[model samples]
Target: MPPMLPPLARGDIEEAADACAAAPLLNCLLREVGEPTGDPGVHRLHAGGRLLRVRGERRPARPEVYADGGWHRLTHPELVKLAAEELRRHTGLSNSELPTEIIDSRDAVAALLAARARATPPAGPYLRSEQSLITGHPHHPAPKARGGGPVTGWLPYAPEAYARFPLELLGVREDTVVEEGDTTALDTFGEAPPGYRLLPAHPWQLDLVGARPEIRDAFADGRLIRLGRTAGPLWPTAAIRTLYAPEDDLFVKFSLDVRITNDIRRLWRHDLLKLRRTDAATASAFGAVPGSAAWLSDRGYRTADFAFEELAVLVRDGLREHVVPGATPLLAAALVEESFDGSPLNGLTDPSAWWTAYLRQVVPPVLDAFARHGVVIEAHLQNALVAIDADGMPVQALFRDAEGVKLLPQVTRAAGWERLVYCLIVNHLMELAALLAERHPGMDPWPAVRRELTRYDTDHGLPEIADLLTSPTVPGKTNLLLRWTGADGADARYVPLPNPLARH
Candidate 1:
């Protein structure tokens, strides 16, 4: 098993949870609303003008707020309160939901920490990496909110808890089956009755939405039947809704009713409708790129007409075929997450070489896809898989998540470019760079990034590259503000963050 937070007493677990939860909240508060106070690791809340001090950079912890002429340490709840007050004043808006989510996120972390102490982490590097993100989405205000549900409801499927279970298969009557693209892979799970088509559902999602009147009616009317789960256990990846089946070497993504990070994780109709086009464009772009980089195609989807979104299952190409033969594909997000026992980043001896190889594998395909095919992929950490050779050097990059891909003609070039810059440079590179810099002090990681971008721009002649290199600020997603304002989940709002590429 990969190393876990040392088994802790209940009090210690809560204390550790406080620190675990505070980092991302502090990051969000500082980025979206707080201003640096010029004192090291100190920031002034822009609205309330309160001074807050924190230690560490990659994952800020041990928050202290200035009051009574001295620093007072804050519990995670206090930190949440301070953030809520600041955001409320900062935006002239009150949000009951966001504050609750912040608290729930902290509580959820506590549960995951405790559960992890008792659970066994997966042995394989890829599965370990996929399940290793305890502090998920380092910038989101409530990265692990879990829909504010009871622990029992989510703990069994949580990746951070190292949970693995069989998918609950259901048989959708053949007459009501609605599918597109190639869904043949799904038939391998189980055989349906003569009149039914096999449909696999996430157990948690089935529990959450199966009781709906429409769904219940279908169940009663013989349109849906409960088929047994897969014989083997499937490992839940960081994206809680997606599970990887080792036996079959497949990834099955199901509609999860819970809200994870920014949006409800249901396979919405709109995205499903466009999945084929977006995925095809992405695959085409990767084919054109002259490297080992690959696109893990979302092969197809299967669902019932009566419960399309709830019963939807997406078939994705697994790593065995796409990854380089001798290399192991690790989740990109896991490399930057708090170090685990088998983490490749933790064992790195040559930071520069590792980073250079990483940049070469990750950066080129993204730029080429945009310039040549007009496909803007969400190349953020969780969606990217970096395969490393025996020496632990990054050799190949595999990008996924067709739902997040944006076609150029569908969105204006300017809008698409902003989204691309936000995902690739800001969300993906910035986090990894910060983690690398933190691990290896005095190592400036930006120059290599700048060089890679410069080389790509030279070849592709993308007009935005020159401006991006010198731009004073790059777009940073405003998750804290977005959540507080109750904005549409798909609507992206960005704040200007100091561009490190400019400095390099």
Candidate 2:
């Protein structure tokens, strides 16, 4: 068992929850629909020209609107209303669901806070970093909304709540099992009876879809049977559906029926069919790179022929084999989203050297893969992990999630470059750079980033790099507008952000 956290009062939890929830909503409203005024921390709504004031830089808070001849503070609910109204007017689209999700996200944070106050964080640094995101996706409007379901239903499995539970196991008859490549690691979880294959399921997923007619009929006809659960518990990673089994050094990703940040967390068949090809290309790219950077491949998947989507489980390579010896792997998202007790960012003694090490480890591989292999990796914060040695300087960067990766001929080079900029630069590097500069006030993080990218461009001969450095703007994903307009999760829509590289 892990060590327990000290309890906090109800009032403190509510206040913390409000602050956590408001930051993302305000960020979205400001970036997507609100226009900045000359005054610091103040913006004018693009639709109505109403002036709004905020407090902080990274995580903006304490919102106030100038109305009725004075500034009136807005609560979390009021802020949500203001965002909805502004988006409705700005886009000329009315969305009743997004407003509810914003409220649901706030409520979910409150529940997570209360549970975390009484829960135990894992002892290992990797798992600790994986489960440390209390303020997830700093720019997303409803990053924590858990399908608007009851707290009791999701709190037990939430990564933010430090959840660890044994996977529910089942046996699929040989003829009914559908598998791809290298799924042998899953067999080690438990022994299957005579002619059945071992298939593990996320308990929450089964609870959501088990009663479907097809699944119920499979169990009734003896095509599937219960085989009990693993003897040990698996730690849920930042991506809540993916869990880590330390004993086996394996990651098991299940098909969850809930909607996380942008998409419903199901392993769709279209993506599953191309999984092997995608993983192979990514593996080849990383293999050719002459560095410690690695790719944690999604080796294979297993499912029942009858319940292909709902019962699917993917086997991913674990950290033990890829990470450098005597080093610890930490989630990139945790470094910027929230700092824990063992966080390397919190323990930084030489911020400039540490920032340079981080840039070297993280930047090259993504660019190399795009330029050399024609493979575009989704190297966003959650998909990347940075390993650090005893003194807390970065040593390696390992990236995962082949399902989100795009191949060259499948998408145009311009489109792939846009995505790379959004994921690698806007989402991953910008947040970390801002956090480092915020910590060390005198440090200018952009020059190091500019130098690193310039070296890569000089050797790789990618023309986009020159334009990127001099361009007035860089692409930023418009999550709030995407959800409001009900766009497909894969159909990325972007807005422009002032390019820090251009200024540096």
lDDT (tens digit, per residue) of candidate 2 on 1-504: 111122345457777788889988888888888878989999998997889999877888899999999999999989988888888888899999999998899899889888877998999988989998888998899999999988889999999999999999999999989999999999999999999999999999999999999999999999999999999999899999999999899999999998888899999999999999999999999999879999999999999999999999999999888999999999999888653668888757799899899999999999999998989999999999999999999999999999999999899999999999999999999999988887788889999999999999887777889999999999989999999999997889988999999997
- Candidate 1 has its poorest 10 consecutive residues by lDDT at 1-10
The C-alpha TM-scores of every prediction are 0.97, 0.97
Report each candidate's C-alpha RMSD, comma-separated, in the order given. 2.0, 2.8
Query: Across residues 148-252, which tens digit of lDDT does each residue of candidate 1 receive?
Result: 889999999999999999988899999999999999999999889898999988999989998999899999999999999988899999999999999899999
In order, what lDDT does every prediction score? 0.90, 0.91
Off by over 4 Å in 1: 1-11
Q: Give the TM-score of candidate 1.
A: 0.97
Going through the candidates in the order shown, the clash numbers are 0, 0
